[model samples]
Target: MILVVLGTHELPFDRLLKKIDKQILLGNINEEVLVQAGHTKYYSKNMQIFDFTTYEHMADLYRKANFIITHGGTGSITMGMKMGKKVIAVPRLIKYGEHNDDHQLEIVKQFQETGHILYWSEPMSLSEVLRLVKSFNPVKFESGNKKIISLIKQFIDGA
Candidate 1:
């Protein structure tokens, strides 16, 4: 199963949904597709979609999924990576009115550079990326917040 997760951004990420729906229509995606659409309103006969779901239910989906396609939200991507799932992150862009800024792109790029996930930047072909996903291996995501945590610990100790 393929899990598609569009995070709770205020605007809709209909573009990514449309592309996935189209790919399913063309038989490029043969696996069962599940989506957490969040605020995006997308209708697809090929996908089992929910506008919103409980965190526990979402966790079940994440566990059952073979791979994950998600927005560039760090939490979602990090969760998938930590689960050892191949994650493809598509950034919500301001030009598409999906976000107020392109900050998600920066996060996606950094994760991509670290080999923790795949990034679908603008002008990149979703089809090609989907093809690549068939054999993609994501590196394990190690927590980088230790430095911040250590500083906090030192501050508390000195206090």
Candidate 2:
């Protein structure tokens, strides 16, 4: 029961979808092209393809999912981390024509440095990464003046 999110970005799925068992793909799609690109009839059977109409609905799905595999979106990453869910964030690159730039990669690096999220560069190892999620122990940030200042600095510096 993996929540395989494609985010708002209508990125390619051919490689990523191949690694999951039971997936729920949430995002844009071209149903006709998906099949032609070898998305397989598996989506029609074992998986769900949804276009989230609102942010609340999307949040609901995020809360309900077992594991979160997403593109490197800070909002999604933060949501998953706050929920203490298994998150494997793969960055989207402009060279891949999947995003405006390589900002996601940098975000992924920063998230990894904080030890709050897991990242997978290649889709082929998603199973191994998912397995590792079960034993992962995330650092729970203790809130205080120090934490507040750190968070503020993060926003100011990153921005």
List per-candidate RMSD values in Å. 1.7, 8.1
Identify the runs in model 1 with alpha carbons over 4 angstroms from their true place.
Answer: 145-148, 151-159
> In candidate 1, what are the lDDT values of residues 8-107, reduced to their tens digit?
9879998998989888888889999999999998888889988888888888889899889999998899889888899999999999999999999999
Model 2, 34-127: lDDT tens digits are 1111222235543565544466866776677766777788877877787877777888777767678889989988887887888877544555
Cα lDDT computed for each candidate against the true fold: 0.90, 0.64
Task: For each candidate, give its TM-score against the true structure.
Answer: 0.91, 0.67
Instruction: Estimate the overall C-alpha local distance difference test score of candidate 1.
Output: 0.90
**CA displacement after TM-score superposition, residue 76 of candidate 2 (Å):** 0.9
Worst 10-residue lDDT window, candidate 1? 135-144
**Predicted model with the maximum TM-score:** 1
lDDT score for residue 141 of model 1: 72
